[model samples]
Target: MVPLSFANQEFTLTTSGALYWPGERALLVADLHLEKSSFYAKHGQMLPPYDSRETLERIALAIRETGARRVFTLGDNFHDSEGSARLEPHAAGMLSALTRATDWVWITGNHDPHMEARAGGEIAEELEIAGMVLRHEAKAGETRPEFSGHFHPRLQISVRKRRIRRPCAVVSTSETSGGRMILPAFGALTGGMDAADPAILAAMQPAERIDAMLPAAGKLVQFPLWRREQNLV
Candidate 1:
């Protein structure tokens, strides 16, 4: 994990893509998309069928590594509304154990907008914590510091003449709107949108600077994605 400061608060970004909030002793992850493979298999696309288990295990590992007493999932906790029902017995057991061990909050997302809290955790459309809004998606007009997930931003960079892509969080900061960070998808099966995509930039507009960040080799590797060009009044 490496220190990442945003909105005047300090956080740690784990290599596995989980964000650790030291002040709150919490772990924030986004877009679990559990059971995504099963959702695809239902449509004649047979995936490995172990996506849910893998995702659950990673979450557990993150909690253990961070020693987080609370967990906040940004959204799409499951691939679909009925995904929880399809959780394999082992994966279901693992999830139950994790929830019982910590304070878990599931924020609803487009994919699981109507998800219920029957899965052993609290449910919310959004959450306010330590002066920051935590939600599933970033609202362009929101003026407060916000932490969200939905874009699953990835940064593609060339290394040694070869191109590589890594999941990253896009951080946007502006004097008027404070700061907004969009976390990468934590699920194994989730796809990514380029961090520099116009849609992603627009979502985090009114920015002085925008950066894509990820943890690498015990350090936070930050790439400047965009900056406001100087304008004369």
Candidate 2:
């Protein structure tokens, strides 16, 4: 884990794509997409059926590492609404244990808008806590400090002639509104969009700068994505 400061709040970013808030003793993860592999197999794609298990294990590890008492899943808790019903016994047991051990809240997303409490967590469309807006997608023209996940932003760069891609958090900072961040997908089977994609940039509008951030070797590395130009009148 590495230290990260956003919207005047200190957080730790885990390599597993989770954010730990020491102040709140909360662990925030985005895009769990549980049972995604099973969903694929339903269409004859034949993916391994252990994605939910792996994802749940990671979340468990994160909780232990952070000693978090609250677990908030930003969105897309499952690949689909019926994902919980298809969970294998072992994975379902793991999820049950975790939820029973903590205060778990599932913030609904586009993929799992109708997700229910059968998964053992409270369901909510969005939340506002400690002056921060938590939601599934970044809303255009939102000025408050916001944290969201949906785009699964990834940083793609050519290093030594080799194209390397890494999951990253895209943060946009504004003079008035503080900052907004799009967290990388935490699911095992999630895909990503370019960090600097126009759609992402546009969603973070009214910003003076945007950057992609990730931890490397216990340090935070930032790659600038966009910067507001001066003297543009």
Highest lDDT against the true fold, candidate: 2
Using all chains and alpha carbons, the TM-scores for the candidates as numbered come to: 0.97, 0.97
Off by over 4 Å in 1: 230-233
Error of 2 at 97 (Å): 0.7
Q: Which ten residues in a row have the lowest lDDT in candidate 1?
A: 224-233
Alpha-carbon RMSD, candidate 1: 1.4
Q: Give the per-residue lDDT of model 2 (tens digit) for 21-127.
A: 89989999999999999998999899989999999999999999999999989999999988999999999999999999999999999998887777597999999
lDDT of each: 0.92, 0.93
* Model 1 agreement with the true structure over 170-195: per-residue lDDT tens digits: 99989897699999999999999999
Runs of candidate 2 exceeding 4 Å displacement: 230-233
Alpha carbon deviation, residue 93, candidate 2 (Å): 0.4
- Deviation in Å, model 1, residue 47 alpha carbon: 1.0
Which pairs clash inside model 1? none
